[model samples]
Target: VGRDKLLRTLQYFSRFYAWYLFRTNRPQTAIAPFESIKKQFGLTRKILRIGKFIEHFKAAAVAFDNKAPVDPILRCLAVGRQLGYAGYMSYDTITVIHALGIKKLANPKKMQENAYRAWLASLVCSAIAGVYSLWKLHQREKLVDRTEGEGAVELKKIQKYVFSMQERAAARVQLISDLFDLPIPLSGVGIVPLDDGIVGLSGTVSSLLGIWSAWKKTA
Candidate 1:
């Protein structure tokens, strides 16, 4: 994940830089360097993502088991999110093969469009899940009752409060990342009118968030 995030950050930055050059009427010679970097990193990321659908597929299966005592709606959202990601990865894997000339797809554009749609669905599910989780946390916060506890009870309450805060913070970060990512897929699928510059910058922001999250986990 860390490697992919780093590559993604560079890829999107290249994309944005290339667009910036073009928008400012810079010579094609000026834009070509970043354009090449963007294409190369994009292909490399696609290669790295190959076969990743299996992971998300397993996650979907686990979510379907419903072993956790999570809220019903959140559970459903989790399953949908995993399934959507699995679908996106599956389609994207094929596109990668076509991209590398290992296989010639008859309709590469259509395949990419489908992949983007699946990704958009996944992000939407994630965003909704984040909002619902935040709402649930808020309800729990109201019931925490920090005033009526003593000694061990007070410590327990304090621990729970801290955990809830952590969960809330994580949810907010994920929601922001999803929001930034939404524009990329939306533009890819022609659902929204966004130029390459906007899409590229949005992708860069989302990639940086992914990097930060991965770094925190490692640290």
Candidate 2:
């Protein structure tokens, strides 16, 4: 995961830098290198992501069996988020096969379009889940009583409160990352008029966030 995030960071930064060089009227010789780097990293990431759909599919299956007394709406959103990501990854796997020339596709462009559409749906589900998680966290926080006198019960409440705050912080970061990522797919599906510069920079920001989160998990 860390390696993938690193590649993604480099890929998007290369794209943004190439756009910058062109926009600044740099010589083609100067801009070509970064463009090449961008393409290489993008292809490498696609290869690395092969067969990743199974992971998301497994997660969706696990979510489907969740019997916890959480809100039904949140549970449904969780399942939807996983399924959306599974669809994205499955479509992406096909694109990678086409990219590698393992099999010629009749309409490579349409395959790419479908992959982007799946990715857009996944991001939408993720963004919505993040928002809903934060709202639920806020409601949970309100129910914690901070004014209780010192006792075992008070200590437990304090601990729970701290944990809830940490969860809220994580949720906020994810929400911001999802928002940054939304423009890429929006532009991919022609829902937005963003140029490469805008999309690349947005992707760079979200990639950095992914790196940070992955680093934390590893540490």
Candidate 3:
């Protein structure tokens, strides 16, 4: 009778343990479905945010307006070119005076003064050009990035305009090349053959003349 009682008790304990395990596992099994739903919800939100961002960029691009007449990059390049020419002229003037042994022709201090002017001018021009070039380069990069995000149509328009400008610039460069090729005397003195110094001086004169003419036109 005791053995039978013990067997019955062991069977009862086993059944109770199985029921407890099942009860404990039910919540964990249900959590998997909730986790899947959460993952799907987060993915959908991210996609929506990205779509909104792209639409905002497109709207802004459609309303883009740059009404200013003057292009800063072109003006900066022009100024840098003029300054480079002027710097070259200053340096060359010293070289010419020294080479011709004209120190004795003028006051001894004149040579020193000219040398100082040349180095100072060259240094200033170089520093300004370096800084402006770097700044303008970065600005162009930003402009390109902004344009690219606009859309295909805007990018095409930009490309077309850039090509047209390039053609115009090429023609201007060719004209300059032809003009420089012509034989021209450097100075009224008739002794200094047309050299790089003279070319630099001519560039300075031409740039100044263009600026003066533009000013007059505006006035």
**Total backbone collisions for each predicted model:** 0, 0, 0
lDDT of 1 by residue, 67-164 (tens): 76878899889999999999999999999999999999999999999999999999999999999999999988878974547888888898989999
lDDT of each: 0.93, 0.87, 0.42
Q: Model 3: per-residue lDDT, tens digit, 1-219?
A: 233223323333333333444446756565445444434432332233332334433433432333456455544443443443344344344445444465434453454344344334433433444455545545665566566645677777578557655554444443343243222222222334554334433433433434444454467
Off by over 4 Å in 2: 146-150
lDDT score, residue 156, model 3?
A: 71
Q: Which is the leading candidate under lDDT?
A: 1
List where candidate 1 sits over 4 angstroms from the true fold.
146-148
Q: What TM-score, to 2 decimals, does candidate 3 have?
A: 0.28
- Candidate that would win on TM-score: 1
Model 2, range 16-109, lDDT digits (tens) per residue? 9999999999999999999999999999998999999999999988888887786777778778888888887888888888889999889887
Ranking by lDDT: 1, 2, 3
The residue pairs found clashing in candidate 1 are none
Q: Candidate 1: lDDT of 214?
A: 77
Which has the better lDDT: candidate 1, or candidate 2?
Answer: 1
Ten contiguous residues with the weakest lDDT in model 2: 142-151
When superposed on Cα atoms, how far off is each prediction in RMSD? 1.2, 1.5, 37.5
